[model samples]
Target: MYGIVLSRRDFREADQVITILTAEEGKREYIARGVKKIVSKNTSHLEPATLISFGIAEGKKEFSYLTNVQPVESFFHLRQSLPTLHIIGYSLDALFTMLKEGEADSDIYQLYISYLRFLNTQEQVRLLLLDAFLIKLFSHLGYHPSLDACVVCEKTYKEIGLEFLSATEQKPGFYFAGGGIICASCKAEKQRIGEVAYPCGIKEINTLRFLLASSWQDVVSFPLDEEEYRLVHKLIYEFMLYHSERKWDDWGKISLIMT
Candidate 1:
């Protein structure tokens, strides 16, 4: 079957437990025997974010064993850059955390493939794409964050003028559990009852909406400066962390790309 390697960890001796996302099987782990041995050909093919085709031998037990492997696309060029690697790392962490093993999701698979294709062809790493990918990925999993208006109120984004960093006393922020942007008033009330929001500016909100709703071709041209990039990165990274039940290791991946 065709699948993308999401992650892998060393098992006993030369073996590994490889987690892969397949269109036919969603995400599943297979025991890859002796991959650490020098003669093993499947070692490189199973790298995270790689598109590979492989055979499997399923037993009556809960796990399956990898029989053979042939990589379809390794995203060679994308892996060559540290920035792109961070993007791949964060994206895989999200997928590994959220995807249910043995469930099939062809749409999500196609979405990730398209993302890798774009990154593979680009010279510069557009982190906007990473933000959009996370947004879309969550949408597929039924967690699309409300971007246009307050989740608690009906106020439209156009009526809002305050930015989180500039405004005082509980400014607007992306309420992760609330699944959208909450107005300052609502945020103030939520704070009294013990809830916090991720600070965001007006421009950040607009860019987030644009990223969420627009196609890749259109989004690639939109401008994203360093400061805006940092904010969006923090917002999405934190959102992912919260939703993933704090399963991710920061690894300085987000901070690594900041420089």
Candidate 2:
């Protein structure tokens, strides 16, 4: 089976427990004995986030042994950029959390590899690769937002605004939690009933629309101004946090490293 190394950790004296996202199995764990030795044969071939082809010998229902492993792509460029590495870490964590053991998702594997290659570019464009990656990943996971039309009235979002509940006050700002835009009528209705307090503008609305509609390559090519980039980043991060219910702690260390 072919897989990408998702994570690895020490298990015993000379063994390491490794997790991989494979084409045959969605995600699986294996114990590679004697992997810590300096002269270990598989030591260089097994690296977190590298593409690898391996043969697995199933020992029990829960785990397996990595009998043979061949490196396919190391993504060496990602090592030089701390932010890109952090983004990859966050993405892999999200995938690992949602993926089920023994399930096959070949399409997801292909999408992942393609996205990674795109991310290795030298362009350094403003649209956060992390944000694009999350949106694309969610699309694959079937949680993609309905941006073609309004979530309330089902009308095309010709031009819409965004509302965000501030993280500090827990106040409902401007957002349509159901799917797409919350029309003026619905916004007024909610405010009349004391459901929300304030309004957030539509300056970034078109950018959101473009993001939802654009291809991955187009998104990477488009340049995002500072404000829009920051807004989109926050939105993607918030959406993921709300849906996954998982706190991402490593992000802070990653940010520090990048700075």
Candidate 3:
């Protein structure tokens, strides 16, 4: 079967255990003996962010082991940029964090493959790609943050009449804990319960709507101002972490307020 390497770590002497994500098997772990040796044939194919075709030996022992592996797409271009590497770091973190082992999710697997290909070829490694993937994945998992209406009052975004760059604390904000956008009126009640809502305005809200509604192809062309993109990106990461029950506990620093 073919899969993308998710992560790996040293096992006993000269051996390592690897985790991979596959469409059929979802996420899995396998032992690759002697993988740390200088003559290891599969060493190069084992790197994280690499796609490889491999055979697994269902050993009599408790763990399945990799029998053979051949390189598929190395995504070599990402190696050239530090920022892109960081982006991939956060992306992979989210993917593995949200995915349950031994569970098949073909849609998310496809999105993962397509996203890597897009990142590999595209020079602009914007957070927009990560944003789109997270939103798309959430939709696949059936957990979109209530983007269209206030989670409290049920007012549509249009009815809220959100304004861009409106700096008043009275403005409606994205309460990650609350699962979506909330109007100013509702924000108070949430604050009374101590849920912090990161302030977001029209552009952030609309951009998120467009992302959640569109395909990856369409999201690539969707125009966004720098600040607007950052705000939405922040919201996506925070929403995922919060709703995923802090599965991505390390995915901290999503702003408490959109600056």
Candidate 4:
């Protein structure tokens, strides 16, 4: 089946344990023997984000053994920039963390392939693409945040007059525990009950909504300034962390890219 290599680790001698995400099988671990050797032709096909078609031999153990590997696409351009490479690495790490073994989701597989394709071609908005990818990934995993209205009271932003706020005073008025933006009425209730609410600014909120709702091609042309970029990044990252119940060690380093 065709799949993208997600991660790999050296095993005994020249063998390696490779983790791959496939369109049919989801995330899988395979034993690739002797691929680490210099003479091995499959070495390049096993790198992270390398798209390939391969067959596996079912084994008695949980992990299967790889048989034939034919390369399909390699994102060679990603190797040009350190920052871009790091973002791709983190994206793989996040995908690895969220996906469970043997869980196949074809949508996720397609999304991953699309992400790699975007990184390979687009040099300008890698970070924006990263943010959109995370949002879209979580959405496919059933953690899509409520963007149309308040998650708590179900009031639309227009109903609450959020659009009337000046640029300098726009606040996301988001409550994480509530799962999205908390309307003014719900915000007061949160305060009355002593719950902490974070502000995500109207511009940032609209930008996020746009990202989640827009197509990949549309997102490529979406306008974003430095501040909006940082805001959306922080919001999506935190939202993922809260929903996934996972922490990324390199988040600080990733955040530095936004600055």
Model 4 per-residue lDDT tens digits across residues 42-137: 998899989999998987867688989999998898767676787788789988989988888999998888888877885654467677888888
Candidate 3 residue pairs in clash (backbone atoms < 3 Å): none
- Pairs in clash, predicted candidate 1: none
TM-score of 4: 0.89
Where is model 3 more than 4 Å wrong at Cα? 162-170, 215-221, 244-259
Error of 1 at 118 (Å): 1.4
Clash pairs for candidate 4: 172-200, 172-201
Q: Write the per-residue lDDT of candidate 3 for residues 1-259, one digit (tens) a residue.
A: 9999988999999989898999999998899999999998889999988999999889887899998799999999986776567767777877777788899888888888888887787665555766777787887776867877888778887767643235455577887765788887787787787778777777777788888777666777788776677677777777776667665533224332112
- Which residue segments of model 1 deviate by more than 4 Å? 161-171, 247-259
- Cα error, residue 70 of model 4, in Å, equals 0.6
All candidates: TM-score: 0.83, 0.80, 0.83, 0.89
Off by over 4 Å in 2: 123-127, 159-176, 191-203, 213-216, 249-259
Query: Could you give candidate 1's per-residue lDDT for residues 76-185 as a string of tens digits?
Result: 99988888888888789888888888889999999999888888887776667677888789878888888878888867775555444455543577888798888887
Model 3: lDDT of residue 102: 91
| lDDT (CA) per prediction | 0.80, 0.66, 0.77, 0.79
